[model samples]
Target chain A: MEFTTSQVIEILGTIAFAISGSFSAIQRRLDPFGVLIIAFVTSIGGGTVRDLLLGDTPVKWMRDVNYCLLILVTSLLTIVLKRHRKRFTVTLFLFDSMGLGLFTILGIQKGIAFGLSPGICIALGTITGCFGGVIRDTLLNTIPLIFKKEIYATACILGGILYFTLLFFNLKADVAKVLVIGFIFALRVVVVRYKLSLPRFGY
Target chain B: MEFTTSQVIEILGTIAFAISGSFSAIQRRLDPFGVLIIAFVTSIGGGTVRDLLLGDTPVKWMRDVNYCLLILVTSLLTIVLKRHRKRFTVTLFLFDSMGLGLFTILGIQKGIAFGLSPGICIALGTITGCFGGVIRDTLLNTIPLIFKKEIYATACILGGILYFTLLFFNLKADVAKVLVIGFIFALRVVVVRYKLSLPRFGY
Candidate 1:
């Protein structure tokens, strides 16, 4: 089957998410199967939730074997790089941030395609972006990153808003997708680099 | 508004499911918020998932605040009954099992109303019966019961199929619902009491 450019980007986003999940599992000293399970759920759980919500038939994963392959390669890499845990951490975080940005845009676009309101679309995008990480943390018995990381979900919400704003001004779809992705990626990187965060409730 | 007898039965099912979730949360030693979250998810998650899949407008909780209140009271009772945990556990489980039976029937009825085929209806019903616990477990940071519990999902599947069979036999909707619920409840109880289980793989 012929693939669209957007589909190609989505596959990349999923792979990035899978790698992030793999690293999370590795950090917790999970065995390979546990690691694989975490990675698979992290990569697909959000999309599955979204599809089920949208009443989309045959969730995206079931429709395509490539997604399975993407996670497979992602898990294998983490297994091979297990010994270089420290060095892998930085790269994995970058990939995860990238995945978060891309996935959020994909989710918003897809929600809009199904004729959802902008509010709902952005909410869905936030879920799409951060839910995988949330599942990953839950599986590892930890508080989810969205709760702790502060900017994680916030970035998706911002990017999703930006995505439609650009579209409203009559920008092309590809341009809007790219702008939203870049905006989220930059915000996440800056927040991490400067140790910026939303204030905690007690604070 | 005139409440149907079936609506009354559904409220009972909801209460039963909520209490079951609360007891499980206590068993897992969750905090107050945790207990509330568990009870709410357990009681409504299955049906919510079913409605979303059917593309129904306005999810169930949005329609009625009573369901949310039911879960809250159930959680409170769970806390007060802490000293009688075992007895309450039994109560919760019995009701929880009953909730699944009723929910499976509910899902099949909705699917049939939507004009879906028997296979889809049965599949939808199984999803409705079992997935709430899956969501509850995922939230509570455990492997889902569906993966570990013997015959949990299979019972739902069998019961859903039987529901359609009764339909084919020209049974009235109400009669078919009761019969299927009985079948599921009996099968589930027998399996749990007798420790009967399906093989882990290749059913």
Candidate 2:
């Protein structure tokens, strides 16, 4: 089957998320099976959630064997390169950010296709972008980064808004998609580099 | 809208799970919003997952305002009864078991309706019965009880198998449902009372 550019980006995002999850599992000293499970959940959890909520099931991963193979291969690679854990930490951050940006746009596009309103679409986009990490953190017994002041979901929301705005003005679909993904990726990079965060509750 | 006995049982299960979630939130010293979120998630999380996996869109809760109202009232009641926490702990356990049994059967029934095989239906039943508490525990920053030595998911699986077995013998649907639910509820009660648990891996 011929793959589109969007499909290629989605595959890259899945690999990135899978690597991040594997790293978390290794750091937590989980067993091999645990590591694989974490990797699979982290890579596809968000998309699975979005599909399910949209009433699209058997889920995308179950429908496509390629996703499973990707996650499995990524997990194996991470496990094999455990000796270079320090080097991979940097890779993890980059992959995670890229995955977040790509998944957010994919989710927004899906919601729009489903004829949902802008606000709900934005919410779906945020959930799609950030929920994998949320599940990863939760399984590792930590507060989810998105629930903290990370500005993670914030970036997805902003990107989703930009997506709708561009479409409203009749921008080319490809241009809008690229710009939204770029915006989200850049925002995440800048926020982490500057150590910026939203204000937390005082009490 | 005439409601069937099965529907009533499902609503009761929802209320029970909501109360359990509210209790967990209050114990963890979560804010009011956190408490409400936990309650809502615990009450509907499993069924939402099942529906999503079944391609049943807008989710049952979105389609039914009564589920929301039920969870809201249950949360409020849990908060009001917080002063009687000691007494309510017992109530929480009872409700939790009841919810497990009802939800398990309901999930199995839905899977059968979808024409899935028995094994897949059993797995779906276990997920539907247990995932709410799993979500609640994860959000509260704890390992899920079902993943541990707890006989929770085991009970659901056993009950699901029994449900199919009864149907295979040409038993009535209502009778099968009731017997399966009773078996699960009883198993839970006995296991907890006897402090029984499955063996864990030494590694």
Candidate 3:
């Protein structure tokens, strides 16, 4: 009945992603239903994809109504806090970074649990960390930030490698998880702060 | 083992979708790798999503290497036909319609297999028919055809309803499927020919 640390991270990440999605919808001046749909998809799209690829159906959100409620509540909060949008920008960045880090590790862990190859696990981790944004951006009719030059998926991949490396050396699972998450979080913060990005590929 | 009519339709649909994806990539002037990736994802993305939501894992393409080979071959064919591109527009439209029809029924059947509600089944069918194009258009940095005035998803939904209605009346499965697929295909052809489209929604 007790929520594990990992579970707590997942919940927090879902809320963060949902808020970001709602923020995007508001920015785009979408209708209320559109805003809610965007928030729901952004919050759960990546995990839903990972679960589907892993053949784990009925999906996580469907299994627990709490996650849906959490997303709904987070999205509603965005509407209330719209007037103080500038203040929420800092909160958005923090939550987004935390979501990216936690989701990356969670994805890698799920891949490992499924007994997938290391390469596939890393890919899965990256997909889990970034695909929701891709879906969100696609729906919003903008180029996905990650695909452009955000250094987002890169951090997830690096963290995934670090995670497996630590596990290879027989490090404790919790310690490895914390370190990997920290690495991804720090990497993203540093990248954004310095305006570092991958070089754009020209056609 | 001999392939059933449904299985054949599915294979043809995959090939058709792959060609459409490759065509989009080529038009966008993507590199060879990008073209291949687009083709592969477009061919398999929808079903992969449907499977994931249904909790069926290892995904269909991964379990069957033939699909990958099919996509690869289809993409290569596109490259060859590129020089004769003017002759291929009609071909593209036909293949695209066939893909839409096949994937719609396939998705609905999968949803039914998973014991989902009728409404969810129709939604699954529409997603299966339309999401690949969504992903392809997103990757190509264009608005998805379905989201525009195109009668894309609408046709799928209508066909799906017909499919279920026929089944509800205890129609033979193969007959119902063929009728549904034909309905979608014909609807698309008619809508495109008549330049009929849904009214655009403005914020």
Best by lDDT: 2
Candidate 2 per-residue lDDT, tens place, A100-202, comes to 9889988887878877777667767887888899889888886676655457777887899899899999999888988888899899889888988754222
Residue B132 of model 3 has an lDDT of: 87
lDDT of each: 0.79, 0.84, 0.82
Lowest summed lDDT across 10 adjacent residues in model 2 chain A is found at: A194-203
Residue range B51-148, candidate 2, lDDT tens digits: 87787896777556678778988898878766765665566677788889999988998998899999999999998999898888877776686775
Of models 1 and 3, which has the larger lDDT? 3
In candidate 3, what are the lDDT values of residues B83-145, reduced to their tens digit?
A: 766656566667778899999999988778777677677868887888888888877888776
User: Could you give candidate 1's per-residue lDDT for residues B2-100 as a string of tens digits?
Assistant: 887578667877877787788778888888998988999998999887777666758888899988887788779867866865686576558778988
Error of 1 at A178 (Å): 1.9
TM-score of each candidate?
0.57, 0.61, 0.60
TM-score of 2: 0.61
Off by over 4 Å in 2: A1-48, A55-126, A136-142, A146-203, B52-59, B62-69, B87-89, B148-150, B168-170, B198-203
Model 3 DockQ class: incorrect
Docking class of 2: incorrect
| Per-residue lDDT value at A149 in model 2 | 46
Candidate 3 per-residue C-alpha lDDT over A1-203 given as tens digits, one digit per residue, 9 for 90 to 100: 89987897788779878987887767666655456667888889899888877868778765566777788788887776677555554655666677788888889888988999998999998888888878888798876868656688899989999998999999998899889888998998898888898777588
